[model samples]
Target chain A: MVYDVSKLTDFHYSALKEISNIGIGNAATSLATMLGSEVKVMTPDLKVARIEEVAEFSGGADKLVSGVLMKLSGCVKGYMVMLLPPESAKLICNTITKEQDSDIKNPMNESLISEVGHILGSTYMTAFSDFLKIDVFASAPFHTYDMIGAIMDNILIQMSQEVEHAIILDTLFTLKGNDMHGKLLTLFDPISLELILEQVNALFR
Target chain B: MIVIGMADYAVTRSPEKLTTLGLGSCVGIALYDPVTKIGGLIHIMLPTIENARFTDNCAKFADSGIPYLIEQMIGIGAVRRRLVAKIAGGAKMFSFNSDASMNIGERNIQATKVVLSEMKVPIISEDVGKNYGRTVVLDTDTGVYYVKSAIKGENVI
Candidate 1:
């Protein structure tokens, strides 16, 4: 079935938002348990955007970000990216390594961050599967510290070959009573997006 | 300095620099004319524009972007015969399970070479095809292309 953006209604948006909220909520809990702190994850900002506009979605193209990317398959085929600004990365890494200020590139620090990413990705996948009642699995997570633009370009180039626009679900995270902040961005491929909408439409019928 | 976004191109004369950041499976094509000191850079995402849903942005694809960039350079005092090209940033950021579409980096490089050859522009230097991302900068003043990557550090092409 061809995916038509105009056919999407507020009901569809609300349903997707509810799913993402649950997913992010679980991820935040996993992060808090690891860091031994109270964590707060805000409601996700969901939208459909053109490929060129994605770089700006997480701030600017040149902004340096620590990203953990994973591929999802089974019920949905798409990608998930957990983005942490430099300050947030340092905070989490320092806490994990028990260092005053650990460098993100440090081997021990990098591994800790990757583990955190793995936890978050798994939590999100499980939440999605439970809500949709479909089988969803995520590949092993990969970590990268680079410009946000470059990280997203790698994913979007492959996606743009098939679709002009993508579903962007962005959520913010913060350490309670602290200044640390991070973001999680999940992008859905066209086929997967169509599948999701089809399921949601079927439910409303 | 001028920054070019994905699927975009820009032209500049001597004393100015053109740059494009975050090339992952996307090719950065830099064209320069030594005599005129004119330069152009394009960040092309796909190999071709055939059957594209959006054709208004010709710079988004290799087949159309390469020629468009060259034409823009010539319009601003760059001689086509004197133009030479440099390229960088077609990288396979992740290794998938033997899917041909996952090898977009290789295809982008191939398409770029074909387009440049068709335009009669000789490529002087290149840094392409790896498993990392790259940020490329082209100096119009000296026709030097600098490629920076996390794995390889930095290199001038």
Candidate 2:
């Protein structure tokens, strides 16, 4: 059977669903290894929306420490962003910085920004790769904190999509071991997402 | 004296050390004269010509900040000719998103230079454009200022 580009959106979604299922699982595995304990990462309820939606979603939080954004490409090109609340960010910092710090009261250091970017990023892409059963090369991690609206727009606007729509994979990451919670949001465009949804739907039958 | 924070600023003659600490994307704009030791600093956010001023409460933008710093110094008996602007901070905190909007740290440094140049104020020193944060200090006691990034130790700026 010839693969039809017309159904790219369907294939992309199927591939995405598969990617998320495995990506979240892999993230859990990596988190457990990093924490030196079993940390359960749950599959979050998914939503599909445009880039602008995330802006409003992020605003509801009391304090946000970091925004992690990466593009997933190779078979399908989509964007995923991990929004870390200040407390969740601190928890990530604790994984590497805990033993060194005698007190938790001190403000989280700047180094933690790059560190978390490394960890969550790998976990995110790993799951993505697992579902696709292929390695997806990602650029160096991009990170920002306390972004005003214009800054957010400036960063996300560069994502020039070939399709007319986007998909949002909003996953609530409950980092179990140390009372820390984070969120992994996966976004997809028509190019790759439609493939995943179709495959998953067929697999269910 | 003037004290500046990352993305923030302050100015006064109350004998406090006017300082801006942990500057990564922002530049600490400090101006002072030896005759009066009158000094001030602005913790400017992004080096932007657009929406340069975030705070209506005070002159928060870099364009506004340099003028404000110089004016405050002169008000305390410092001459414009004797006043020199020393800038610190504006370190590129992360290299990952080179494509993202506003290379903020770099922009901060450039904008500071532009504004000071237009005012005919010479930039005596600058410690900028690295993957580090700088702690800038202006001494009201002897009218001297210094900039130090934690990893790079102390540099007179």
Best-fitting candidate, scored by lDDT: 1
Candidate 2 lDDT over residue span A95-199, tens digit each: 666653322224344445544555666677766666545556555556655432222332333332133235566666666554776667666564564465554
Question: Over the stretch B1-157, how does candidate 1's per-residue lDDT look in tens digits?
Answer: 9999889999999999999987878899999999999999999998999987678889999999999898899898899999999999787766652587668888899999999999899999999987777888999999999998866788999
lDDT of 1 by residue, A53-170 (tens): 7887767766777888888889787788888887888999887778897889887777777788889888988998887877888888788787777778878876786777878888
Which residue segments of model 1 deviate by more than 4 Å?
A202-205, B50-56, B97-101, B150-156
- Residues B1-157 of candidate 2: C-alpha lDDT, one tens digit per residue: 3444333455555367877545556677877776666777787654443542224423435776677767777776778998787787666655655664546667667888998999998887777776655667887666567876545678875
**lDDT for position A155 in model 1:** 80
In order, candidate lDDTs are 0.85, 0.59
List ranges where model 2 is wrong by over 4 Å: A1-29, A38-116, A121-205, B1-3, B51-59, B97-102
Weakest lDDT window of 10 consecutive positions for candidate 2 chain A:
A148-157
Report lDDT (Cα) of residue B155, candidate 1. Answer: 96
**Model 1 chain A worst lDDT run, 10 consecutive residues:** A1-10
TM-score of 1: 0.89
In terms of DockQ, the best-performing candidate is 1
Residue B89, model 1, lDDT: 77
